[model samples]
Target: MTFSIPNLLSLFRLATAPLLALVFLVPENQNIANIAATALFLLAASTDFWDGFIARRINQSTSLGALLDLLADKLLIVTALLLLLDAERAPVGACIFIVGRELLMSALREWVAQNGKSSTVRVIAVGKWKTGLQMTAVPFLFYAGDLWALNTLAVGVWLLWAAAALSVWSMLSYCLALWRNE
Candidate 1:
């Protein structure tokens, strides 16, 4: 596997996932922990875009890089969601919806692949918006306990619900497209 700068960055972000979780587990350093976690999360999320952009620009896109990018995104988001769930900032229903969507989508994608359908699942625009909403909300919720001045956590919860709604809509759109193709 050829290692490029962007791929290396993606790997670095993946490495930070566990550290972010560790930050949340420490009670005494909760505030600093939250800040650090937020920074790491944002950095990781940004790399999602950067890696893809760089790979496409330099014609360095490889199967491994694409897989690593997807894995990193999922890992970062799932890690943040679990942390939010632990903090009780993210509602149980929202967490369930998010996790459920991921599982169902994975299964559907696998089934499609097995059937010799298109291997590439294009990330739709709405899906991008959903991801943006999720990334923004999850961190705010994570840092909510630290900054009490504003109702950031509540806002994050609302955003989470919006993300869930968008996820459902996008999933339906994808399914419809597949159905139409079949």
Candidate 2:
């Protein structure tokens, strides 16, 4: 509950989720909206890296800060996925796998924590890869256009698909670890 700097960064990311959706609501300025949303998404995603780094560096890590950081990441990514889906930049099936995996993983984490086996479901390498790919994809998806010489939307969709696959892979990895722990 302490208003630590890391927690504040997490809160900023959480708040930016809704604003990203709102950015797309600007009916007349779709180009401007896309640019703004992409910028905001990148900014928020960068905070995901910084919050954890700063927490560890400054010895400000707490259970609350950890929870806030996790929640903020989930919120931001889910909101962006929904936005991409609504705009037709993301495939429906990939979105389903990504979102469904997230829900299942979140529930599994809670169940593990309640059973006093939280470490069994702690973030794995695959999970980190999934998150990194997801964060990278979303901004490109949000832009949905060329960036210099690259067709961002195509790159984004490809990355999103990879992320989705990793989502399933990470979920399976976590479940296996949990089973082994028990």
Candidates' C-alpha lDDT: 0.81, 0.92
Candidate of highest TM-score: 2
**Best of the candidates, lDDT:** 2
Residues 1-182 of candidate 2: C-alpha lDDT, one tens digit per residue: 79998999999999999998898766579999899999999999999999999999999999999899999999999999888888889988888998999899889988988989998988888989999999999989889888899999999999999999999999899999999989
C-alpha RMSD of each candidate structure in angstroms? 1.9, 0.9
Model 1 misplaced stretches (Cα beyond 4 Å): 145-149
Off by more than 4 A, model 2: none
Q: What is the lDDT of residue 69 in candidate 1?
A: 79
Extract clashing residue pairs from model 1: none
Q: Which ten residues in a row have the lowest lDDT in candidate 2?
A: 20-29
> In candidate 2, how many Å is residue 157 off?
0.2
Cα error, candidate 2, residue 91 (Å): 1.0
